[model samples]
Target: MSEAESELVQSITTPLRLEYQYTAGVASTRFLRGMADGKILGQRCPQCEKVYVPPRGSCARCGVATDLEVQVPGTGTITTFCVVRIPSDSLDIDPPFVAAHILLDGADIPFFALIQECHFDEVRMGMRVEAVWVDAEDLGPTFESIRYFRPIDEPDAPFESYKEHL
Candidate 1:
């Protein structure tokens, strides 16, 4: 085929789909209970005053066992983001989405999630975002319980807001 035709064909074709699955021990029943209640729960690292979402049973940084359960706020600032032009098998969202690292208010570390309800170009690295909660009836013991992050109406925060988390 001509070079132009080959390029056109490649662009038009979709990639193959691959599938896999694995079985592991069930996650903690307590963690699931937290998500169902519209709460972002984390395990605390007293040594560093750091909180971990998907609450860890132990602190990876300080190498100390953690048992405290902390509730992280839903509001956060975008530390960084990438305009996703390509869809991946693991992601449920459509293409041209924004994947961002959000530093939850009062949390030491940032959590990765999608930024929706705004144009990709309008999303900035330090934009303010708030969690759009899933329907109360739809709440579950999973991250999906919180649907996605949406732009906040508040004034843009200074770079200092989430700079260190990055």
Candidate 2:
């Protein structure tokens, strides 16, 4: 094979190595408890009336301490997505998956998650999606508490549905 072809093959076949560790805080404990019950929790900003999922202890937008704990709807719309042709060592999923930015209903910002049980090409912006909760017994104080999101059978959401979320 030519040098260019050989380089391309090597690049495609080589796996990238990544390593990292995360330590949770006290606020995270409560968030995990909510997830164990199949609830999506968020911290609400009293000043701006915005709710953040995967709840942060403070409001970054308003730079204020937000203490109100609210339950956000699991149903949401896909704001954006990319097909994951490459896999990462930290990921628990298979390759060629779809990663998406979803704006849960009643949330102020979009959060990242995986989309599965559907075709990659078929996943699109503004598509309605719902949380696929993990098995109750398997729930934890981490993102793993909730499984991936799946495309809902509902009709395609209109452009106005998730445009601002982008």
Candidate 3:
């Protein structure tokens, strides 16, 4: 074919869709159930005594089985964060919101959560925050059970408290 004809035929556009189902493992099942009951559950590593939220069933560092269940408080500290200025089609929130890594109390690993109900500029490392849960009747086995983390009235956590996690 001529180069002109090849260039004309090279471009195409189409809509694509996919669907799938997921089965949760024992650790995930237990964690999801705890979320449904308005609780933050973690598995304790017997070797190191470090608690992991969204338990992985085994210690990544110690390589030991983690069967002990520990309930961590919804309160946490913001170890790090960023201001999201870009808009997204999937989320209803406006631009310039804050997203942060929260070191939940009693858990060794930190997890990501959106920050709301406060000015984005006020967000800072070591800021104390707490989960804002959905209505009781709307609770389910999902992370959405907790809408987002918000700054609390308590003083910010000391740097020494969360420096290792960062």
**How do the residues 1-166 of candidate 1 rate in per-residue lDDT, one tens digit apiece?**
8887767544565779888674322234556678899887777787887877665566788998667788878988899989999978887788999889998877777888989999998999778899998899999877788789999997776888777778
Local error of candidate 3 at 43, Å? 0.6
TM-score of each: 0.78, 0.81, 0.90
Clashing pairs in 2: none
lDDT to native, each model: 0.81, 0.84, 0.95
Q: Model 2 misses residue 155 by how many Å?
A: 2.1
lDDT per residue, candidate 2, 62-145, as tens digits? Answer: 898878898988899999999999878888778889999999989878989999889898999888999898787887667777
Instruction: Give the 10-residue window scoring lowest on summed lDDT in candidate 2.
Output: 6-15
Candidate 2 residue-wise lDDT at 43: 84
Stretches of candidate 1 exceeding 4 Å from the true structure: 1-29, 89-92
Can you write out model 3's per-residue Cα lDDT over 1-166, one digit (the tens) per residue?
9887767566678969888798888998999999999999999999999999989899999999999999999999999999999999998999899989999999999999999999999999999999999999988999999999999999999999999999
Superposition TM-score, candidate 2 onto the true structure: 0.81
- Model 2 segments more than 4 A misplaced: 1-23
After TM-score superposition, the amount by which residue 162's alpha carbon in candidate 1 deviates from its true location, in angstroms, is 2.2
Backbone collisions counted per model? 0, 0, 0
RMSD of 2: 5.8
